[model samples]
Target: MKHYLPQVRFWKIISIILALTGVLFTLIGIFCTEGALAVHWGSDGTPNGFAGKIVLVLIALMGVLSMFSGESFRKERPGWHIPVGPEMGYALSTGLTGCCAGVNVIVVLYYFRPDERIPAVGAIAIIVLYLMFIMIAFYRDRRYNGRDVKTGEESHR
Candidate 1:
């Protein structure tokens, strides 16, 4: 557990940094909007509808929730199973980071005009970044579990 503490702390810090960035972006968007920010886009790559800047607030909220969720899942849990277990910290770390990343990208796209949709390539890039983050978290989890603290031997458990 002690050996894993530093790694867990690092993940938490990453989450916090992303969350704060999202919040800052949201605040800027809020101030830049006149009446309401464009929150919906049409299939033709144009803004078709509008909503309050609360949408940005929601994105910021998701960021903060992700930071807490990632921290909560960084600990050991004996009851969790393999695929969705504590040993697989990928879901929390990768999901939160990906979500925050996506939100940040969206905020950037709309921050100035509030009516622009993200380019298709930007969306694809976010997905690829998410997959990469998942792989990283998976590798970290495996490395963290390489040794069994109780048995003091190579851990297969």
Candidate 2:
């Protein structure tokens, strides 16, 4: 259980880093770009005028929320039972923070482009990365569960 504290701390740190990264990227986009950042493009690749800096603001806000959510997991009681224990709680909180922040980071990169168009592959890659984070968290949860069972220790305690 003591060793697990390090793992939990690591995830919390990662959450903080991700949130900061998202916020920084959004700030860069906000300052470097002009009015009406491209939010959407038409079939013909023309700007639909639906895109705006507001998207960046929304994404950044999500990033901030993600950071706080992860921190809350550290201090708050686990409201749900699916995660089962601290290990899973840390994993879920950290993974969610990373995924949300990653989205903002991706969008900032895409929107900051000179042409204001995001490469399809870049967008897809963000999704893939998020899935990878989920897998890692799941794996960690299983490992912690197994360890507790093998050691005859109660996971909740």
Candidate 3:
């Protein structure tokens, strides 16, 4: 068990980092309605700065939520399965990300064409992809099993 402690701790650290990034992105979106939208970077010519920021924030939140859910699965057996909240969050976040990625792929392919919705059609896709990656991280964590110290039981985390 002692040998696994360091490995478990490492996973916890990863979860913390993911959570922090998600919180940061969500906070960025929350504050973006203010003057944050008007600012411009180099000539990135990206989507509307404000909207993009908000999307990123949403993606981050999705990541954080998914991580929490996955971590829940790894917790002691008393509450590990996460039949509702965490499982739902993980599933939704991943699905959203996949959908967004699909949209972005289409948008990028047809970017040269002039269409009314062309510019922003794929914006959500970027956020979706970001969210999906986070979800995947959570999925991996959930899939990995770890020991429960108190019970000495071969529980899955």
Candidate 4:
């Protein structure tokens, strides 16, 4: 497990960086905008609801909390049902954090550009790409750590 430290650290750093970026963008949007920020969007690429600027602050806090949670990947916890190792945890954390950051950026974009709207397909594509990245990271990490991807067991080699 010691060998997995570097990889874990890398993901943790990436998660933090992305989270911080999201927070910064949110703060900027909150301060620069005059009215409530768009919170919910309809499938037709229109925001049907709005939220106070404080919501952006809460979102920023969630981003920070998520970065902290990603630290759990550094070590194993007792009695955990999922047999995820540290490397896999870190990779998954990065994926989740990346998604949150994407959402934050989109929110900020909505604030800055009220006339524009993000297509639902674009959002779905972003999610799919992040999921693919997470899967690829897990596969590569498992190969590097000498584990069988299908069984999640150590390889004889």
Cα lDDT, all candidates: 0.61, 0.60, 0.43, 0.69
Q: Could you tell me which 10 consecutive residues in candidate 4 have the lowest summed lDDT?
A: 1-10
Which pairs of residues collide in candidate 4?
none
Q: Rank the candidates by lDDT, best first.
A: 4, 1, 2, 3
User: What TM-score quantifies how close candidate 1 is to the native fold?
Assistant: 0.67
Better of 1 and 3 by lDDT: 1
TM-score leader: 4
TM-score of each: 0.67, 0.63, 0.30, 0.73
Which residue pairs of candidate 3 clash? 25-57, 74-157, 97-128, 100-125
After superposing candidate 1 on the true structure, give the runs of residues whose Cα lies further than 4 Å from its correct spot: 1-7, 71-82, 85-87, 90-94, 97-101, 111-119, 147-157
Any idea how many clashes model 2 has?
1
- Candidate 4 lands at a TM-score of 0.73
Question: Which candidate model has the greater lDDT, 2 or 4?
Answer: 4
Across 9-44, the per-residue lDDT of candidate 2 in tens digits comes to 656777778767777877887788777665555665
Using TM-score as the measure, name the better of candidate 3 and candidate 4.
4
31: Cα error in model 1, Å: 1.8
Global local distance difference test of model 3: 0.43
